[model samples]
Target: MEYHPEPVQQLILCCSCGIAIPPNPANMCENCIRNEVDITEGIPKQGTIHFCRNCGRYLQPPNYWLSCELESRELLALCVRKLRGLSKVRLIDAGFIWTEPHSRRIKVKLTIQKEVFANTILQQQFQVEFTVANQQCDDCDRVMAKNTWKAVVQVRQKVSHKRTFLYLEQLILKHRAFKNTTNIKEVRDGIDFYFAQRNHAIKMVEFFQAVVPVRSKSSERLISTDIRNNTSNYKFTYSVEIMPICREDLVCLPVKLARSLGNIHPLVLCHRVGNTVSILDPNTLDAAEIQSAAFWNNPFSPLMNSRELTEFYVLDVEPLGPTRGKLMLADVTVARASDLGTNDTTFLVRSHLGHLLNSGDHCLGYDLTTCNFNNDQFDQLDAGRIPDVVIVKKHYPGRRKKTKRRTWKLKTLTKEQDELVARKQDLKRIEQDYELFLRDLEEDPELRANINLYKADDARSVMTNGGTDMDETETDFPEVQLHELMNELDINDEPDEAMQ
Candidate 1:
């Protein structure tokens, strides 16, 4: 080969000195190559087989046993990200794998697939899970704050680290605590930022409603509102099957009011940060605590005896479960008027709070003896009574020890007499209408085409003329009894002869 010196630009430089090396293949200076080979010599290339979709490890980590935990974490994380976006999250083990009844957070466990050692391929194939959680915030890596979310996850088999499993489990706990703490800090900071400088007030208020859900039964008045300004002064009396929400999700809130845009409650702060929630309103707390009908009638006091407690109001809520599973709907209100005598009322209301159903469910403390009377009209219709609905006022004795006037609200308490008035009014209107129809029929032969008029007349006639004898015309139904008592009404003879 003609050895014309190659252009200097193509020359290789020595790592030791700035001198150019020969123009051979990958021409590092001979000194640099020798040094690299010496440093690289005798190092064993260790590799792992099992690869997790999450940690990408062949071996599963401890405390990541239940698939439910993993699922809840992933799901809660994802949900938080979507709704609140990159929010801090807290996850606590309610000590059991089953979802906590009153928990608003999803619960899941991590899953580990078995490792299939492939002798044919000459490498062990560690099959791991790529399972993501549902109902969780994936981006935020936190759980949700629903009333309850119970999800379970079962792995293929046991983990290999039997020796250090206990230690790892503690580590997991620490991690969870840290996560909850950090989240709480972020939430508090966010609250400060979110509710920053604004008009000053002695104390701003927030509302918290307690809702009970029952699978069966329906009501019209499902929601009732009670506003509370003081949260630190009182706590909601929520009964649970297991444990109630603790300091983690419910922290002691500050006395000074932080400015807010009124978009969300401050109680959500603990939920956002450390699983510690600070509820804002006093009135809402009172209402939520009064889940027990007994409590509603007589304010729970350490000093007052049961006999000393005021008048009665029993909630006919869903039956209590073995534990706190039976939750009373918190939305329904006591419809009786305070001015009315003991348990004397025309109608009561059943209002909704958090959900559509006015009934309680198997989860929390729901008053079982109280019957919410939205209005008797709906029930009356089913009982085969006349169709008319109206609210009647009633009074109840003083609920507070000091106040004596009374509390008054609408209730659906209808006596047979009340219903009778409704029926009689309905019948009288129909009779007048029928009388007009007959006159019109006589006036215009073209009106004969109206079969509806005939049907209505026939139905009304049958209702009035129960028997062939004209004396049987006014037989009594449920609504008629009250009218008879009040008005001394008598049943006239049946008017079948009039039909003839």
Candidate 2:
């Protein structure tokens, strides 16, 4: 209103750099003030990291936990990434000072460079502190808390044996298939795996499908619902049933099924030498594999098990032909253990222990004559009244005394024994594969060259005398560097196209 220009305002100079700037409380220019300001202003003095004591993993954000051998470095990186000051400054390098084991506090040295002014960059070093908090991750917490699973996988086989479950358990452990499983329970005929997520259960089912022939059915139940938040929680159950047959069992095939299977045999022996079940004609010594679909459509029932086996004494034996590896053909005259009379049955049978059998030797076999034949008319007609013996093992007379006959129950490996054997076999196979891989690496020219290129100078010198050094004659062409060698021949290179 006075229309008067204010008296000429006096300009002040920066006290530190002697630069003229607007008057302010500090009497410093914009550049000087900016340089003086700390870029870590909004950063927390003490950062907390959630650590899972159970699994020894550190929590990343949003319900994710990372597993690493160097937990401290991982935690430090995660905490540094969460700092708000990092957005304003350019980080050059950062390092953590060593702290005592189990220390709550961590110290980090950060070298940050910031462009406070045009064509002007300022670099500074500062120390930031972090606090480690021992807390359970979501998975570990769910595992610790009972009955907190989001999905349950019930692995079962309809057979009376747990052999398939045992094999599945070994596969799971060897491949770490159940890495996300929260709990495992050993049921009567199978196993139950509890997972924290439905996807994990699905992943497990997929693994089963890849390795074992399985059929799965899934169902879900509503746990809770939040109408306001539009969220619902559910618990899922996946029932995965494996094949109902195992190795070394006597199964009766229907007449129609036998005809479908190339009229092989009605009274077939189930021998699971590999993944598939090979139905063998005990009389003709012919075999045919039963596929998953065929087996599911017409599943064979076990007519007799190993426990129903009895001993027989060989009266006379004659080799019919040349041996076929461990199997051979022989005409064996044998009498049952209960019958020591001169009446002995002679059978032209395929025997695994034919070479070891001599006159008067005792052997164990399943008595097919006593098998119940109700609906299995084909077996009743084909194997009726004939004391055919499927030789299993050799027996000694010095063993324990025979016990009284009792009711027949299915024979199966106990849980402990089966698991132990499966684990051992899995480990043995892994070791053998590893050894074969090492041998191949040593023998493969490209792999050997690449390995030599990465070896330390001292190791190379030591290996030179043994003629195992990298091919130095190719130096004229090109001295293959480590990176080039890696690109050319990787140790984990896939199989050749022809092999695939």
What is the TM-score of candidate 1?
A: 0.15
lDDT for position 252 in model 1: 19
* lDDT tens readout by residue for model 2, 188-221: 5577878877899999988888777667899999
Reference-based lDDT, each prediction: 0.23, 0.62
In model 2, the Cα lDDT at residue 175 comes to 60
Model 2: per-residue Cα lDDT at residue 216: 80
TM-score of each: 0.15, 0.55
Give the per-residue lDDT of model 1 (tens digit) for 105-149.
333232222212221111111111122222222212222221121
Clashes per candidate, residues 3 or more apart or on different chains: 105, 0
